[model samples]
Target: MRNRKNIAVKILAVLAFLVFLIINSRSISNPFRTGISGAASLPLKGLNGAMRAVKKIIPFASLREENRLLRERIDLLNRRIEESGTLSAENRRLKDILGFKNAIPFSSIPAEVIGRDPSNWSNSLIINKGSAHGINDNRAVISMKGLVGRTLEVGRTSSKILLITDPNSKAGVIIQRNRQGGILVGRPDGSCKMIYIALDSDVAPGDRVITAGFGSVFPKGILIGEVAAVGKEPGRLYKYAIVRPAQDMTKLEEVLCIR
Candidate 1:
């Protein structure tokens, strides 16, 4: 049985060779026939298909890498855009502050807010400008929004501002809406309390408050803040009111020094 099986395999191989030889002979005699070329090119076509599969996988990996790189570039661009926006806003605010200083009759200096009091509730800031820059004690410090504080202590190159919200700081203010007068005093919690406001005064919430320039500390017409709330104690002689400071002290970055 084994001998017969071996003979059968040899016969099959010999038959296939004869078939190939016949096909080649016909194509050689008839040039229009494609049998020889088709048979000869089969191995190359199979190899090309395998290569195509490999090439397809390569592109997929390349596309994934490319997408990752593109995402990284987008992230970098977004960060740059955010920084540019912040810079533009800062430039505008600084320009406004400069314009305000230019319009005033007093000599002015520019300063950058460098630090704040460790006590968060304390209304004070340290500036980069001081005696060296002509900033002196009691010089008014202001921002685009309004009065920030007065220079409390002066160093060679830096100064500390006693913010209007400091408990010891006070400003004589008038109600812009009705010309009522009051003493604006800072509370420990960063808001101003209006003292000596008449009980029957026509003051209301949202009234604009401005420095009266009576004490000669702050300039007239400098915006201080808007009325936040109003209330009266049962036996008090005056109505107590809270004023929201125009300058957002927590966000202060730059200021003008008025001499």
Candidate 2:
């Protein structure tokens, strides 16, 4: 029994000595440490690749958001440019109206055209001024270009004007070049006719017409229109002319009332 115990002790001592040698000696443990390190590094390398891919994706999303903001800014600038152009044109037209108002010789009231008669659009207009603004009935209305019409009805805040193109409108006009007298009346086609012109009169197309100041209805020397053509009625003893109005009535925006 003593000898068996001795052999067991010897075996235990040998095993402990081998473990101590492996921990203390670098050359002996190097292959095992290298194998362990290589095994662990496989998972670490995969994790590193995943982190790099996430970083790339983040910058791309940021770029997309930046591009979207840039597009919005460009659209906003375009609308502002268009609005500026419209405002400039309106300013120029108002300046022209002011200059014309200064040139007229009568006591005048400036009024804006607010509406048109839907039932008689080409023949009448509604102005913003009324009796409250000293607008009176039968007052002459003119524009920067030429005569427009006369005030027909007056109200508290607004008034209606009968344009010279209306069938019921009439004025005494004369040929400006020769002083030939005639009566001007409106036609349904939005033009005027100068009747009572003598057949022997040298009235021709391109001749200008102006108010004759007869009956004190309209002031003298106000432009009416130019003669487009001249002809005689078959059974009548006089000649007539088709007169185009000096101003474009369809585009009227402002007017002056001869107060």
How high is the CA lDDT of each candidate model?
0.78, 0.81
lDDT of 1 by residue, 168-241 (tens): 89888999999899999998888898889998998889999988888756878788899999998788799977
User: Quick one: best TM-score, which candidate?
Assistant: 2
For candidate 1, the 10 contiguous residues with the lowest summed lDDT are 30-39
Give the best candidate by lDDT.
2
State the lDDT of candidate 2 residue by residue for 1-259, as single tens digits: 9999999999999999998997887776545633443344345445545765675556555555555757766655544554566567778888887888888899889988766656653588877777778988888899987889898757656677888888889999999999999999987788999999998999999999999998666899999889999999999999999999999888887899998
Q: Give the least accurate 10-residue stretch of model 2, judged by summed lDDT.
A: 33-42
The clash count of every prediction, one per candidate, is 0, 0
- Once model 2 is optimally superposed onto the true structure by TM-score, how far is the C-alpha of residue 104 displaced, in angstroms? 1.3
C-alpha lDDT of candidate 2 relative to the true structure: 0.81
In angstroms, what RMSD does candidate 2 have relative to the true structure?
41.1
